[model samples]
Target chain A: MTEFDREQHDHFLRLFMGLEESLRVFVRSLLFTHDEEREVMQEVAVVLWRKFDASMDGEAFCRWAFGVARMEALAFRRDRARDRHTFGDEVFELLSQTVLEHSDSLEAERHALDTCLQKLPEDQRQLVQTAYAPGVKIDHLAAQLGRTAMALYKTLHRIRLTLMDCTRRVLATEELT
Target chain B: MNTKDPRFEIIRRSRDGNASSEELARLEAGLREDTDFREAYVRYMNLDVALSAVAKAAPLPLPTAPPQRPRWITWRPLTAAAAGIVFGMLCTSVVFGFVAQRTAVKKMPLSVFDAGLEDAKQILNDGLPSQEGQWGIDHAKVVSADGKVTPLTGLHMLRLEPIPREKRVKNHTSRAYQVLDLRSLSASAMTDNAEAEVSASFCAANSGTSSRYLIRAIALDEAPAKATKNFWSKVESDGVVSESQRFDTAPGSAGWQTFSMTLRLPPGSKTLVLIFGAVPPEDGPQPASVHYLDEVQVSLLSSETPLP
Candidate 1:
């Protein structure tokens, strides 16, 4: 590869790596199903790389990237519009706006979530990880645990709420310093 | 935290894509109207995303084995089938009951103007009566702005001009306004001290023009035919009003900006009017300008505490 091409490739990777987590969060907020979210995120990454120009500054990258992600999400929704219980377009708009507005706080919360996950008791953490593992179905997990699906969902919900509360407290305390 | 908070149930159902039509509508309205609910929904969704990310980064563990069945299961097929049928029936009933409850709570809000300026005009001319009373618009034309003839998503948008061309040349200044009667829409759900949220997307033809778009929720003791006669004074006299920040696009900018504001409905108010208008620039070359508006919505923000 030419030196210029190599430099461009490296810069693209750096920006992708820096914003990967936020991009994933943003895409997932618009999409509920994991597979679709992953598909859209991959498409967004490719688009961002192909369009990476020097005019785009680091500070504006997230906003620009999110705009691309939003378009991808809208397309995905159109493709899946016939699916049962799909979110309305207004919901997607609201979510996109909210994520962009809270991107900074969300990044902090993401970090705090990592810390919070590590602090989870071993069994609870294992349950959460296993439940979210790439192809694991919640129904199958519930059957394995000898619990009803509703019970399992409630348990997972509690864990999520706990993490949310913990992250909020951590961010609040951080703001005090 | 209440483990049985209905909001959590709604969020969970929404995340799982099992939320019925009514539940979905309720969730959307809540997100638009309540700050705390919106924040909670965003945080929960973010945490779910974060958890999934963490799971993907970590190595997967071996799957757990299913519980063992008794060896005599072969001989008890008939008995098991009978029991299974009974269990299936019970499960079906429970599922149906849940769905019924969800749909039962569905309250369709009175839609004043959802889309198509022609339909809005027809309704205005026909004087459609809503729960609160009759509804009409002052002066609105469906016009394309900045070459965006089509809406961001819909087919048309209402362009409210601040000053008509003929009137602008005559007086060199005039306030053109469009008011949509929202009393029927708001009165159906809002009580005294109830909070409602109004949301819309707006854009200006030229950023340099003194053109400005303002969305206001005014509580009136009675419906007014036109918005021009001391509306602000009446709003002051009536004492319950909420207005969004005046929105103006930057020069050369070409995109729709979303604006949302929450308002408290006052007691004894018979009508709620949503006013959208452009204020003509005093000294700009383009004294008359049209402000494009679309996707106007109003939803009540419930303040009820979730049941334990």
Candidate 2:
């Protein structure tokens, strides 16, 4: 490989891969569906890498990366202007800005989820994992388990709330100690 | 964490695709006005992303050992694997292959638009009291599944509510026109005996009067934009075929039923416009009556050569 190309790949891969999860969560928070998140994340990665510089440090790079993510996600939302579920441009701007402000706390909550997930009952944790498995459709899973789709959805929602409660407790306890 | 909170319902339904437009509006408002709601929203979404990442990294939950939250799924593993000089050349190709595949990523599913309405907004639905987004509608208000109903598959379904009496015209059935491009198929699939099979799931309130689930399929040699002009004018003579199922939904009736119709493509047809319609009985529409549409699909069938 050419020295110029090798340097670009090395520099881009290190920073980009390291921040991949943050960028994903950032973009996903701004969009409605997982597919939309995947789409916007790709666009964000391309824009970040294409304009990436070796001189930029972690903080500057993160700011720039998040800015790109915000724009791309908004653009994606605008394309679906007909969709009723999507946030309007004003609401989207407000939410994205809020997410940026709370990025650090959100990241902490994200870490807490790892521990909270383990605290769940074995069956519930198994179900949550199965639900989020790659390309796992709830309907198909429901049929396999002899449960109706609505029943399955209700169960999943309850599990998520439990996880949320667990994470909040974990974070609060951490604050105390 | 309060399931009883309206905010929880709104947020959960919005994520699950069950929230109506009104509920979504409330969610948007809460996200803007309430700081607590905003924190909850951020936390929920953060948890969602983290769970998905963990689930993706370890598809099977480890009952015995805790699965680590994967920071970057493949990077560390690949670097460790690359430490061996014996497989230097092989490792380089594999790493480049993975990077190239990731860097060159395109957007989602192969279809140009999401047919399932689960992802992209290619399919136009529910413009207002008398319109279906870009497509004009009949005596129907394309509405979202509300407290009384839910979507057949995804979080959203087209609920064909009655149009206002003053705005309603006589003999106008409640339906939406779906214009599908015939150019999407292979040349071999567009034969003299080629047929376009149209199918969609329909549902009604169980305590409703009898209603006719209707479908009218037509093939045109003109473009989609031009086909609509001559659409209602054409009948079931050559390229068009219509089929329907009339039923009286009882207390324990089937919720959503799939209906289909097939239209033989007139040779050299360029487009297909399907009318997914609903016909009420001679009696006026009932308060509990509903005509819902979801999971619409169009596929090719042939007498000689199979659909490629």
Candidate 3:
């Protein structure tokens, strides 16, 4: 490699090396397996190099890298190959029973969720708080905010999806570690 | 029809706490008839339960672990095609990420002006009385800054003043015309009544037909037949008209025809609309002389009189 290219590669490596372990675990949950997760991380590194190879500032690189990691995981799972295990009645029942019996797993899931919430923007954090506040019904909050119930429902739907992904990643990495 | 199709209704009833035990059993029986529906409903219910539980419980600390790397990173490339495939996938994901980020940044719904109004005016609708028949202001004329007149058409309304011809003489000017359309205007459901009152003013006639124009007002009322027939009957009984004569300086005529008319509305009617039209006489090039209108007011009248 040329000197400039080598410098760029080293810059990308340093950038990838600095991301928090928690962020990595968060990204890995979106992937089906460890190998796929690793593949996504490498792609993230390559993309960071391509984007910021000229300057490679740490802040820009971290954001770019994690953002790329998330996309790669989503794209990887979007492939038809990952749909082999269909979610059916039995699986759903097992999942519910699992949640009921394994309180620690539920707690672990909650912990992962809290961590993910911490990672969100300050505005999003407040939104989650307001949504889940005790005795504050969704319909009442929606009316107070001049929003329809359907709109609030859709917002909660997106938040739930994000939490599921974050929790899955957190638990997966906790197992690995 | 499949029992699964009624799932939403049953769920809504359950959510509302209005479903009886028998109703719940019926819903459950319906759910069991379709495996896919039952599985989906179970998953949805469980997710809701878990999320609700988490929302209720105290926050917990999440695990911290290093992210895994891709398996292909350490693997040797087999061929140029394989390398190219890997490279392409990486590039595509990065582009997709960038696009998603940009889209999120915009945070606005992309909309175009296809609802059909000049200048993209929002269609005014609030349960006001709808137009009974074909109603709109179509013809218009542009007053150039150079004191010249130009014909306008296909444009319904303008909420802006007409830029005078002399002012529109050059690059420093804009071609302006007074336009109006009353098709989409309506009254709010909660409101009692709505009406529009407009007045047109014309500059005195010059050597030619510069300021001479015609003003026409059209109103469309759409309500139930009972309300409309009552409104029409009241208009026929209590309608007032006062006509007078006026002299025109340019034509050196003794008297010209002038008329003023007002129609009272009936009771129980919820919506009333008024549309005004101003047409000008035909000048040198185009025949219609454009007239300038002054004050136009739309007001909701009191609902008190009951129609017989």
Candidate 4:
């Protein structure tokens, strides 16, 4: 590749690395299965890389990247419809709109989320981490922990709700200050 | 926010892919109708993704090598032999089972509607005509009658005009509908033992106001006496239409798109109604909206177990 090409490649990589976590969150909000979400994110990354030159500056990167991610998620959902439990088009449309509208606020909340997660009690934090571990089945984890899968899921759900509430409160206070 | 909100449980189960079909349906309805529920659902999913990222960032400890086994310990030859035999049998069965499944399932396209507007027997208008002209199908205009613009296959396409707010006021609402009845074709092809998949290609150009385009699949016990007025009345009442899916069109939305939905026919249903039109905006006069529809197709798949 030419020097200019190499520089463009490096620029694309930097932007991708910076937005990778946010993009994953955006993709995950649209999909249920973890594997499918990751697959869609990978596809989005490739498409973003190819179209990086055409992307405008300012908040355009987030808008364009999330737009691409939305289409990828929709296509993934359509392909997996017959085999898996997937949300309908209307739900996805609403969810995508909500995410895009709140992207800035959500970015702020992400910082607050880190603090909220750190404040989680040791046992709850461990449960949250183990539940989200790569390739780790909730049923298997439940078996290892000597609890029913539903019970464990309920615990995780409660922990997530608590963290979300805490993050919202933190962000709200920050906005006030 | 109530911690005990059952909606949260539904959201959790949905995220985990553990939600039942009924729960999923309820969640979908809530997402469409309830704003607070939708916000909570998004926040919960965002939290799950954030937690997953954190978990992945935290490095896992490297595995330590196990201590060497004692020299005295050894595998039992008989147990090993039995295990090998069982594994071989299991692998053979799995391979054969997979091949059998692949060959047994069949996806057959029962019927395809590729003809022009002549095939459409009934055209019903739910709203009054605008001042420019009557709101109905225009067979003269052609927007890719050959289905090149859209993924539909047909020789002729129907251009449907949207009723303005004044026309909609006659119908008691700002929404207007132009319905095409395909009961003769669909009823003949439908069977109680199979599910029908209906799909259509649509393109819309909205004026200043936004409009919602919908393709509703309705099944009736019998054809209505007055197709236009009574049909809409029945649609207004519950239990008249089987399934309906909507697509929203903004001012700048000007491309052909395709949408498909599977309908489980209700018992004692004889006639099938396919309604296509735009829903008008309330409180003001609606901008002129035009929709081009073509290549409507319905295929049936038999729900029978294949012979081995």
Give the top-scoring candidate (TM-score).
2
Which is the winner by lDDT between candidate 2 and candidate 4? 2
In order of lDDT, best first, we have 2, 1, 4, 3
Q: How well does candidate 4 reproduce the true complex, by DockQ?
A: 0.17
lDDT of each candidate versus the true structure: 0.56, 0.58, 0.36, 0.55
| Every candidate's chain B TM-score | 0.49, 0.51, 0.25, 0.44
Candidates 1 and 2 compared: the better one by DockQ is 2
Cα lDDT, model 3, residue B82: 7
- DockQ of each candidate's interface versus the true one? 0.14, 0.21, 0.03, 0.17
Considering every candidate listed, which one attains the maximal lDDT? 2
Please write out the lDDT profile of model 4 over residues A78-100, one tens digit for every residue.
77666655666687778777776
| Cα lDDT over the full model 2 | 0.58
lDDT of 2 by residue, B1-308 (tens): 35356677677777777778888888888888887887787777777777766664345634344223322112121110001011000010111000101111111101112233343334445321111124434544434565666766566666666544445566545786656656545565455445555566677755345556676665556666665555656443344433333333444555676655555455566656666666665545454255776666554543332112
Model 1 CA deviation exceeding 4 Å by range? A85-90, B1-5, B60-308
Give lDDT tens digits, candidate 2, residues A34-122: 65675577567656755778799877887787788888787878776456556666765666666767767776776677677768887
Which scores greater on DockQ, model 1 or model 3?
A: 1
Q: After superposition, how far is residue B3 of candidate 2 from its true place, in Å?
A: 6.4
Relative to the unseen true structure, what is the C-alpha lDDT of residue B165 in candidate 3, on a scale of 0 to 100? 37
Count steric clashes of candidate 4: 0
